[model samples]
Target chain A: MLPRRLTRPRITLGSPVQLLLLAASFALAAYAGVRLLADDWFGVALWFVGLALLHDLVLLPLYTIADRAIVGGLGAVRRREWTPYVRVPAALSGLLLLVWFPLISGRVDRRYRTATGLQADVFLARWLLVTAVLFGGSALLLALRVRRAAQHRPPAAR
Target chain B: MRDPDAPRLPSSPGFWRSPLRGPWLTSVLGLVLLVGITVLFVTGLVSYAAYNPNLSPVNDKTPDKGILGFYLFAWPTSPHWLYRLNQGVHVTLGITMIPVLLAKLWSVVPRLFALPPARSLAHAVERISLVLLVGGALFEFVTGVLNVQLDYVFPGSFYPLHFYGAWVFFAAFVVHALLKMPTVLRNVRHLREEKNDLVSPRPAEPTVSRRGALGFTGGASLLLFATTAGQNFDGPLRRTALLAPHGGVDPGSGPNGFQINKTAVYAGIDAAETGEDVWRLVVTGRTGTVRLSRTQLAELPQHSGALPIACVEGWSTSDQWWRGVRLRDLAALVGHDDDPPDVFVESLQRRGAFRSAALRANQVADPRSLLALHVNGEELSSDHGYPARIIVPAAPGVLNTKWVTRMTFRGL
Candidate 1:
């Protein structure tokens, strides 16, 4: 029912509604971008684009390699079933670090102490303690599972 | 398009080998974000409104808010714990959802590198929106987390930066969600992951099932919640919030043992100025300006209310007993006998944000709202907003101006 030009472009992809909505989204984003850039263009743009690149190119690759290494290392001991136990604890610990790195590293020591009157020094120790507990607890659980599996095994297989 | 024999690029389908990355997984993560992000956005907006941004150029931190302030209304006062509950949920849930967000990103990351960049105009537009969605999410989360930790290395003030970034991000988010919703529903309903680039052509031996990965993410979120939620409470539980800025033991003991966001030294409060003999509470309104000393304020019809100090940074104190004259009574003293208009409160805080703030008329009229003179059966210490302070039910802590020196009720 539509005209030829409209139908032709429409066949390529998306309906008119989709295009309109996308345009609206772009316009809103542009407005916000203008406001943000007006204050701190360099920092805002860097954080906006650079973080994506950093995560995709650098952080993802590093974490993948680390995970691969962990899996490979466990394979040497034929304890590959234990990978989740290690992975779970490590991921959780890494997440805590990611979210609270400023505190855990004491990067904001004087400012934090002055503003809050509490020692930022405590976070580093607390984070370490948490990591230890996670790993220790996971190890304990793995041990129990291994023992239970061993007991369930057939004599011929053993 | 005809050259299928050429060696594959990184963007080629063959490069990605994660067997776990599939539409089913992506859709699952998307569903979680649908709920989580909606809550985050709503609570974030509510937190902004609680500051009563309508009182522009005074309490409004985000200048030129324009149409974005459409939802702005006088934040309520009935619950008293409203701001505390809202902010606690906002910060705690924001932190807890990180694992889910990361996993969701990981699930769809290969799309970020898809070859030819765009096959059609629609596809190109979709991809651009994806960039905004991802970038905005990261920017908002990073800035928020950093601000919570009191790390202000980022350029610009936290208010406008976060406010603008959120709008941009949510705009893209809405588009992306709508475009992808149908696919998500179909993928989830069918419970089948059709073979695509996300599926490895030659997968290695599987280490864990898809369900296991999801469980791990959920467990990580639960752990974060456990560590972060205690900052919203008081007593022994407060120490459990080791990751939060105000999670440690109180600054001191006894009645003054609760958390304080800014110290007297930090706010640059002069001891000489705030002393009882020198301090004077100035009231300006329809009647005219009336200056009253600290003793004069104590002599007024003293009232008390149990209220909490809830900070936007997401830490809150328990309901400490606050005693002083009602704000409406103060308005009455200034000749507003029937209804109080909006009031602007000024503090002697020489430095930092919220040195002065404005309150909504409803907030002014609230019986619980007071010019708090004492907290928890003792005169407030210098660090605890000595001499006098504003205490309005359900208002953000910063807006409750401290070291009060002037109050202009109505017609500002």
Candidate 2:
């Protein structure tokens, strides 16, 4: 029998796009940080609110989907998609952050403005820092884990 | 060398035996060099803290690092070999220390993975501080690279993380040192071959395996190589380290507190004042006119002149000038130009929710201070206090009142 067509379900936000959106929120939060250091206290407060939304609503779903997709894709590569995959969210997010920072601004003066502004700057720095730590750390861990796995594997027949 | 708390030389063969003596030797020498560098850096004498950024060894020369006979000039002009050497030394040593720090970290990772003495408050504080230190160090290193990249510009953050965060970092490091003192001393003694009490006479054995141990050493080496080749990522190091130069001047000028930004003597001043003899600061109220209004003088000679206005944030390029009718000229219309004891300037915005310092009338009238007419030889820059301003030099810039709506002098 002929193989079934490779069909995907209709979704409002593309799984990849959802990840993009989540990352964009983080980028926004980072951008807001610029204003905070400039002593624009109002900008700080907005980012916290933005962060809550991004983290809970967008990032969580995006990460969940992306994680599943990767695991699935990894399996599929051995079982289906044959090509190696790369996760490009960090680079994409970094690019988005750089390009759009000047174009957008967190609300200058709201009750939550000061906090949002401060949090935005700090959160961005914190976020970037944390990302670095995670990436650097996990890369090292993954390499070691793979090495360990290979060492444990039985020798292949010539 | 026989100290009381020395590490035993190796007799038993385990995984971590290789790192014992070598790391200790490395640590002792490294720590000495690091401390020496820090002492020279922190103490103002051999200040790398950008001082007199524009002051050149030559007239109008940009300040640079000078040794017994050598001098390092600013970049893109005549590169100073000596200065580059110092910069190179600081960078190289800092990178080299990474391995030492990582190995030190590796040596201690056994204890690190396990929970600290968390039940006690001191233990919790210690644990928390260690987290901050690790996080801060990693950050300083990475962001430092991001900052260095000329092509890949991260947004400029004028907020002084390193400047302010140094204390936090220093505190955490000290705490970590204190907490690890017993073991550190053991390691030091083992390396130095001093004296100590031990269950057996043997060398040190690090907790991490040879392979794992090499992971850290190799990683540090690779990263350092990358950094020297201009590929190391700039992270928090940018914050903690001396900044690169800007506008033909080194950024982060002043070792600790001696930064000279564009905020200058004429920022808020009356440029119309040609002489100190005729200078008068108008404090709104006299004997009866307790709170003066704008309508006090109608037929007065209101003259104006353009003056230069600069602020320190390194943004010395705005045309907004000191634009205000001479205080004395305006004061001659109503109050005496002299014999004024105190001047109280009011901000257009309410003076609450902010830090404030005041100036005496005599201080204001020092003639160095001015109620400027124009900034950069033009009309007032509105963002820079359009109508008028008080220019206080050598005094903190915050004291320079902006958008001066009212000026009042009281004799009492």
Candidate 3:
């Protein structure tokens, strides 16, 4: 049986193994923190915390608003059913942009060329081509589905 | 029952209108990450071990890595494709999993802004651990992605920062996984969605079903894999890896046109010193030192073997026909004729990280290992390690020291 002081707050607090493991996790994080701070403390610390805020406070809101606009704009035209066709392709393209932003934007052009002896300029064109394909493919699928549905309906009901 | 006085928007649990953001969706994504991240961590550790950090100070990039290096052993030499497969999988899979990770975060985001912060002492501790888990994940992924792109915006050297950051992230990740495993199992067992904070109290009409959302995420990951995995191969397929740094066609033409991580010029190799007349292969061991010129090295019987050069940056070249004197042959010249001992190799490059590297005794004895003099049928180009270079099987590209300088055997 555990003592009252330990268990009074919560059952988890009474588990010594859990507490010990938690302490170890904190210690490891601290060691990494100290080593990271030793060199570029300001940059490292800013990136560590700032990235989280950027995702939650900034990127998330921007995307959510964009998604809402898509939904709202389509709903007004009585074509809300077409949202998936637009959303899926947009989400996939946005993800590619997010991952390969540096290359696609040519931000690392000089350094990348010097290091690998290959041009970074190819990325921007390739990304645009890929985005076009995704949207085109999705729109084609939607057209097929719409045509099939119209053909299957009874004339009187239509 | 909905609280009449509940907070507005995101803090109120009513703002997130996705009907699909619930335990089932979160758990499915969690399961994918459970399998995917475990592979990432193991392969990441294997990539570290490939550097042979146990050699200390020479190849060891993470200096204060005390107990963290317990799993590292003398990396193998038999398969020859070992390092190539390890690095290719590590980098390619890491990029492929980004969409899944972002989706998982999006699923559980409401908890990040949960009001009052903590309801109890245990709750507060759990929240703090969540902070470490989230922060550590973003830090590792961002740094790793930036490095692959040749962007060095992040502060400090990539080696120690990544090594240490991995430990912190994995520590919290393991704890978080352990705590959530039971709940995840229970949630995934049933198709029935459970009510929780993740479930929107005022969800809008469903544009996409839960299964549809999962499929979209999986499809996104598949797309990334198609665009990224081609960098590991050769020929026409290599052009498909548009998202990877080495996806473009090889620079220049003909046989020596394949990828090179750094040019001779960029590595600070002085072309004047690397010339056949000035460069000398210095071999030292129990028999004392022997200095041999490039012409003399070619005179001592040449051997040819095909082997790939795999870089830590995750790009690799297909097997180039390398002709040279075997490392074991050189070791024999320095007295250890029967079994070649560990050797320390130095290079003429005046700059960069691994100007010198050490190899284990087994690596020295590998039949394929060479002091390569000619790549393809032609004499070596200045960009491809000029007068002479070390070429060992299944080792990281950096460990294959370039330009002939000196070698010390049996005392590493």
Candidate 4:
């Protein structure tokens, strides 16, 4: 156990300045709430609540499950070190996909083409290419790391 | 690559937590996120103010009845790249911040599940603010990204929702920072000391080192940056911007080769309505309003300068030579010429979010502020606001007031 000196509680969380800031923050939020309510309160409120729950529940779990599957699948092969190398690229690619979902899905093909004066047909292919580059780059880094580690190993240990 | 005699590892629920879930990682990522959020907020405020929403409602012609937008002063016009740079950084930083925001959120995930959610009033308030911070941040980023893509996934209007959400997020950000500063500073200093104390052993977690976590997060941010920043950065980097929604393509060709936010067709503007003979620009002053024919407008002392059309949607075009009467010159046409007052610019288009806009005093006074009649060397295309449009330096594309029909100077 820690000594009494370290165990004693300190007022680290809040103070006068922090309280004042909290007040100001609350005031700002209240003002925004009024503005939001004045303009489509129900719809905006529903979006906010629904989105928050969706992110925390559905999206978080979905990503978590996906990550675990990758970790588990890689772990079974005793390739734990390679998990992050794959995960980072995958996550980044997924985020890019999320940001450009409409174009990739061809849902907004006509609208996008009309607005941007560019073909939406190339989006899916471009995303695929970017994803491939990310994975390829990661694989290269992993290969280099393995080569360096192998070189550093003693002959007897090898 | 494991020892043959070593026992096989068993999957655990806690194994998913990142090794970078410590205070130091949170602090560093939080600091970066703070800087990003601050930049976004500041630029967003400038953009909002530039709208001069206080002068007039975007959707309504009846001024002084809508929201008190503090539209008291006109946004500046000099240093022509002002809006371009602010909006560029606003958008690029927002995109790069995706990874940082994710990492910061992930770093603090464990805290969300902490037992007994609050112990005191302060803790309760902190938790409340945390909810606002997370919710507001998510709302802002998601809506912002979608809006830039012109995807109206949400049901309500974008401007008001986004504007209000910004305040909520900003408030939460301020409070969260205030509450977390001591802890954040302590952790940051602890990290620095650890780096300096070479004799001390490094953190021993083998799943993923702090360096690895930082590397991956930073790499994701950089990748996001490289892929999306071309919307504003242009140049050779533009080709690599695979994710840029509008890759610097100017819809108009030749003398009119400048990117467009709203085309005549898209804006529901009839082609026949914009004929030179039928078009006339009305300029209201202190004493009276003067109507000028297209030919008369052409006869005025025309000034030419290159100016970029920067949009709030985060796409900007290369500078195109614009020729027309200066706004100050137009203001001079009527009495009370010196230090011109705020002017309400009206567009010929029957309906649109930006059919009309309020131009602040500074915008009214700027010499570069033009009631443009021609682009490059040719007459303005119907799509490029034929007859006349207001093109002010550093003003948002929307406020450039396409197909300008009237300008009523609000009393000084």
Looking at chain B only, the TM-scores across the models are 0.96, 0.37, 0.96, 0.86
In the predicted model 3, the residue pairs found to clash are: none
Candidate 4 chain B: worst-modelled 10 consecutive residues by lDDT: B195-204
Give a tens-digit lDDT track for model 3, residues A57-103.
Answer: 88888888999889888998989999988988898899899999999
Q: Compared with the true structure, what per-residue lDDT tens digits does model 1 show for residues B261-305?
A: 888888999999988789899999999989999999999999999
lDDT of 4 at B78: 73
Off by over 4 Å in 2: A1-158, B1-112, B115-125, B128-282, B285-342, B349-357, B360-363, B395-398, B410-412
Ranking, DockQ, top scorer first: 1, 3, 4, 2
Pairs that collide in candidate 1 are none
Segments in model 3 whose C-alpha atoms lie over 4 Å from true places:
A1-18, A31-33, A156-158, B1-7, B191-193
Error of 4 at B17 (Å): 4.2
What is the CAPRI rating of model 1's predicted complex? medium
Any runs in candidate 4 off by more than 4 Å, and if so which?
A1-24, A142-158, B1-17, B59-72, B191-205, B233-237, B286-289, B334-339, B410-412
Q: Evaluate model 3 with DockQ and give the value.
A: 0.51
DockQ measured for candidate 4: 0.36
What lDDT tens digits, residue by residue, belong to model 2 across residues B267-356?
A: 333433312243333445444332223233222333443222222221121112333445444333346556544455654533321112
lDDT of 4 by residue, A27-58 (tens): 87887777765757787777777776777667
Give TM per candidate: 0.95, 0.34, 0.93, 0.85
TM-score of predicted chain B, candidate 2: 0.37
Docking class of 2: incorrect
TM-score of chain A of 4: 0.76
